[model samples]
Target: MHQSFISYKNFKSLKGSVVLCAAVLGLYVVAEPSATSAGGTWLGYVGGCLGGVLMVWLACLGIRKRKYKNTELLAVGWVSTHIYLGTALLLVVSLHSGFHLGLNIHSLAYAFTVMVILTGFYGLYAYSIYPDKITLNRDGMSRDSMFAEITEIDEKSLALSEKISPEMFAKISENVEETKIKTSLLTRLFSDRSLKEGAIYKAIDFVREQHSGSELIKELDSLLQEKESLVGKIERDIRYHFRLGWWLYLHVPLTVGALLSLLIHVYVVLFYW
Candidate 1:
């Protein structure tokens, strides 16, 4: 019963995009240019205009999404339209170029368009997959709650380790001090933090070395295991969080670059060419 942005209004944007692409394809097929089918021709001009409009509209989606009041369009509808029309814009641009590519500013604009669209595709995939993954990883507990619980476990483990031995106490303290819940952006996104696991394993080994089957050691072992589980969940949650938004960093900048290059390309074509 839950309708996602992709399925908004019974795939209305998808249908519109398909129709638009089909119509453009028909025109491209029928148009007979004086020479090559390039951006200078009549149909090519149409395609260029459509592609330009679509590019500007797609870029506006970031602004549209940020508006929270008095907007006529639903946010989901805007997103759905953005996804569908953005794809169509690629084909329109390619046809507008008459499949011709060269080491020129026009091609540079097209290249930026390609990069922006590719990043947008990755963003769409991330949005679809990561939200559920983050929810499952958190399991109804906020990240702050998980960290708070880890701190509590560390305190209890420190007390138990102190009663057991000085070496155990020192090891537990070092582990707690070195355990990192936050890391560098690239590290959080690409690498798993395993220091917490090493500390837990070392503590378990130390307890086993003591050769005592005492309840205090048992409780300490349980706490270490619990801490390990929480740290793993937090690391995974951090990865999912970064994965969801990192593409926007590339996508937005490339969009701005593409728009600027497109403006220069249009200016040259209209006034000089």
Candidate 2:
């Protein structure tokens, strides 16, 4: 296992180095005065070249890594390199443009690169922070297990409700059904209405009127307390996903945009030069 880890580490490092080297070489070639002598356009060439090379390198690294192996450390390092190099590409390309943007395909491509980089940066932040956030948010409970516990609680609740007023039992049943559908993080977080609050209020009002002196009221009260705790857990789960969702929206589009811009840059350089 140690040897395997070492091999994976070395492979990841070598892959990163190749990409870095290609980026540097591409920038150097573009910065050469010969290609832009008449127009002083070396900066744009250098920036575009560097950006394009980095994009290709990133793509190659992803494909190669996916095909050969899965290593957590290597994955982390690759992601770190991707983020920093993406940022550097933005700086290099922006400088290459001499900070002049206009209404043209070249400028549009540049804009797309910036958009890609910025979105990637957001994704990196999410990637770095989310696992910890998820752990903390879970409060030592596995989300799946938490739902299972809730299900068990629902079963207990239904049993106890049978001893109570029929109306109160029906209300508990409704709440249980609603809660079951809201097992996922996204559903809990984005739910516009509060299921627990609604349930609790209805239960309280019904108990005060219909079953004030019974043993069933006491059991119903205990179930209400359990429901409240479960609701809080679900809320935390939802919030976790809400934070994670932003990264997906940003990362995916930016990745696609970067590829498109890189292609445009490559085609322009090859054909126009």
Per-residue lDDT of candidate 2, residues 126-228 (tens digit): 5566667778857898878877787887788788887765766797788777554344455544544544456655665665676477777776777667667
TM-score each candidate: 0.93, 0.71
Over 44-114, each residue of candidate 1 has an lDDT whose tens digit, in order, gives 88999999999999999889888999368888889999999998988899999998889998999999998
Mark the regions of model 1 whose C-alpha exceeds 4 Å error after superposition: 181-196
Instruction: Quote the positional error of residue 255 for candidate 2 in Å.
Output: 2.1
Each candidate's number of clashing pairs is 0, 1
TM-score, cand. 2: 0.71
Model 2, runs deviating above 4 Å = 1-40, 60-73, 178-197, 204-216
lDDT agreement of model 1 with the native: 0.88
Q: After superposition, how far is residue 192 of candidate 2 from its true place, in Å?
A: 13
Model 2, residue pairs in steric clash: 43-96
Estimate the Cα RMSD of every predicted model relative to the unseen true structure: 2.2, 6.0
